[model samples]
Target: MRAIVLTEPQAVALVNDWPDPEPGPGDVVVAIRAVGLCGSDLSVYDGDRAVPSLPWVMGHEGGGEIVATGPGVVDRHVGQRVVIEPNYCCFDCVACRNGRTSACDRRRIVGMNDPGLLAERVAVPARFTWPVPATVSDGALGCTEPLAVARTAVRRSGVAPGDRCLVVGAGSQGLFTCQTLLAAGAQVSVTEPHEGRLELAEQLGAKRVETAEVEPFPLVFDTAGVPAAWDTSLRAVAGGGTVVMIGMSRSPVSVSTRELVQRQVTIVGSLIYDHPTDFSATAAAVADGSVTPEQVLQAGSHPENAAAAFAKAREAPGKSWIDLSSWREESA
Candidate 1:
């Protein structure tokens, strides 16, 4: 098996002859099909994320075909297409018991804490596998993880009909947030400096696109971790409106507390999604034509072009698709 290993901070390599995973009881092995590159993965590569794990395969958003199943797994069989949940939680935890597994104190995110699916094959618990609809493409299915994050934010926002929503940043998660808000019937706007992503936001259903030239929004969600985004977000919030901070900023963000206090604005910080099945919901939405993941992502990238994909993502133009089939071709 071949895999992308992030051996340590700031180091990544494609390793060949990696031993293929063997399924344990109630576990399953999936043949990787497509993986979506996310900002969190970039944070892991850049060492901004402090969850200490090394020599790990770094991908949480992936979809694949079941190659084998372990004992006690009878509902799904070999050759079934599935999407990985990528969330590991201690069911005994208080948060888990409350159905907020994303907030479980003992949660270990695959690719973040455990070995990830950015490989030829990935082993995971059968409970974490969601059946992928035949109507869904592999690339779109792979994005279920991130879409779950956006979904969670939308779920938390308590968005009412006809409310205005603003998403700050046009990154992967930010664009998804915009789409979800629009789906909820909010008048959505997006703030992104990157022209390409701003165009994509418009394509994704944003009513207004704000660049350096545009004015501040009334309801704001900061999906870009930059302090500037936060600064703008605080100013953009309409009185009694909400601001959801969804991005990861390494440093402390300075905001005017007085402004928030004066406006009676609500500020909420959304972590990741809590329910493993949230990924399934995202997949269902994709399959049913509510969410189009392919429109948000560009074409797939081969191994030779893999570095370029990472570079392009870092440059902030568009999200990249890692085609596992490309690895097979490269090896051949």
Candidate 2:
């Protein structure tokens, strides 16, 4: 099996003889079809975010077919097309017991804490694999994980029908958040510096698109996660409004306590999606045509082009995916 291994900061190599994953009890080995390159993966590549260990396989969002199932895996079987939910949690944790698995004390993300799907195959718990509809393409199915993150942010924002909401950033997650808000009947506005991304926001149903300026909105989502964007988000929200922070920023930004107190502003930080429910809802949305994957997943790259693919994904307004199926064709 071949895998893309991050050997050091700003370094990646294609290892042709990487050991294949073997399924454990209650797990299955999936033949990865496509994997989505994420911002967090880029962070790891740039050495901005620290991982649990080094020399890790790097990818989390992916879709594939089950190749083999281990004992205790009853429902899922060989040849079932599925999407990966990358979060693994300890069921006995306090947060898990309370149905907040995303906040579990021992939660581990696939690419960060465990071996990821950037290889030809990966071993994952059967419970974390959801069968995707045949109507969805492998490229589209690879985007379900990010869509679930967007869904969680929207839910945390509590943006209802007819509410005015502003989404900061027109990146992949920002665009997904905009679409989700629109599906909930909220009047959505978007702020983005890139003209291509701003155009994408309009195509995704945003009522208004601005490079920097925006009128005060009742609900604001800060998906950019930069200090300047955070400052702008605070000023863009209306008094007594809510600001949902979905993007992760590496540096700390100073906030004025007096302004928050005077205006009765509420700031909430949203992490990744909640376990089964959020992942299931995102897949259902993709299947039902509520969320269009073609709008987000722009193109596919081969494993040999991992470095160039990451660069392209960073500059792209939408998402870019690695086409693992091409490896078989080339190797054959």
Candidate 3:
């Protein structure tokens, strides 16, 4: 088996001869097909995000075919194409009891705490796998994880019918946020400096707004973690409207207390999905053409070219996929 091992910050390698993993009780082994590179992968690569340990397998958004199942599993999901849900939580936690499992007292994200999907095969808890519809493209299945995050953000922000929503960014997550809002019947607008991302946002059903045109919208969604993005979002949301923060900022920024008090603006923060259901819903949305993952996926890279993939993602315009099957040619 081959896996991209992140040994340290800004360092990764395609390691060969890694022993193949076998499924445990209540687990499933997936022969990974396609994986999407996300900001979290970059964060992990850059050592910005917190992880329980290192030697990390740095991808979570992926889909694969089930090659085997554990002893206790009886779902008959073997040979099924599925997407891996990366979140695992302690169900007894207060947050999980309240349906806020993303904030669970004990949470282990797949790539961060355990082995992830950026490899030739991944063995994960059977509960974490969701059936990928035959109608959905493989690349689209690879995108459901992020789409779930976007869906969670929309669900948290209380975006409603006829509301004017402002998404302050046009990257992968931001674009999906726009799409989710638009699908919910909100009048969606987006702010992005990148021409390519902006164009994609428009194609995904968002009105593009230049910095000069910033105004108060009914609801503001900030997926860009930069201070300027939130500052602009604060200025763009109407009085008493909510501004939801989805991006992971490295540090805290000062807010305009007077403006927040005067306008009664609500600032909310969203985290990751905690269970398989979120992933399932997102998968269904993609399968139904609601969230077009195909449009957002730019290209793929082989596991051996993981470093090249990172460089490309940093230089290129949009999301990139990790093609784990790239090693098969060598074997052949």
Candidate 4:
């Protein structure tokens, strides 16, 4: 089997003889069709974030057909097309017990913690797979993981129809969040300095703002995880309103707790999606034509164009995918 390996920082290579994954009980071997690139992928490639180990197969957002199924996996079988949920949660954890599986104390995100699915075929737990209908578009498939994240944020927001909502940043996450907000019946407004992204936001039926509104919003989503964006989010959300913090930023922001204390503003930190529900919500929206995530993603990049894909992924960033079909065919 062949796989894309990151041997070192800023170095990714295709290895032709990587060993095939052996499915254990409750697992299935997926004939990987595509792998979505993430911002974290760029950070790891640039040596900004640390990986658990080197020579890693780096992809958490991908899906394909099931070629094999392990024992106890009765609900799923061969030839089933599914997307990987990536987050492996410990159901016994405090968070999981409280209905917050996304924050499970012991959760491993594949491609970041475990080996990823950037190969011709990879073994994954059958429970983490979500089946997609043949009607779902490729664009939707390209952003399953991200849409799940967006879905979680919306689920956390407790948003109501006709409520005013603002999403800071028009990146892939921001755009998806914007669309999800709309699908949830919130009047969405997007803030981004990038003209192109703002344009895209308007196309998604969101009002594009030149800046983050200083006025209060019932729910505000901050997808841009920078210190400045944090400050703006705190300032923009009104008293008694909720701020859904969706950015995975490590940088610290110095802000007063006056708004939180005096105004009763709530800040909710969101990681990835909760198991089962989030993916199902997102996939349903895609299936119903309520949202189109692949609008931000480009065409598939073959293994032969891995170099070009990396460069393109870096250029546009976080909107690229490695097409595993070619290699899967070769193996066949």
Indicate which candidate wins on lDDT. Answer: 2
How well does model 4 score by local distance difference test? 0.81
Error of 2 at 172 (Å): 0.6
Model 4, 209-245: lDDT tens digits are 6563457788889998888788778878888988899
Models, CA RMSD each: 2.4, 1.6, 2.0, 2.0
Q: List the residue pairs that clash in candidate 2.
A: none
* Each model's lDDT: 0.79, 0.86, 0.81, 0.81
Q: Which stretches of candidate 2 lie over 4 Å from their true place?
A: 52-54, 328-332
Q: How much lDDT does candidate 2 score?
A: 0.86
Please give each candidate's TM-score.
0.92, 0.96, 0.94, 0.93
In candidate 1, what are the lDDT values of residues 265-318, reduced to their tens digit? 898888888775676678678768887767677777865455566656766655
Q: Per-residue lDDT tens digits of candidate 3, residues 67-120? A: 889899998477788888888887888988987788887887778777777778
Model 4 residue 269 distance off true place after TM-score fit, in angstroms:
0.7
lDDT of 1: 0.79
Top TM-score model: 2
Which of the two candidates, 1 or 2, achieves a greater TM-score against the reference?
2
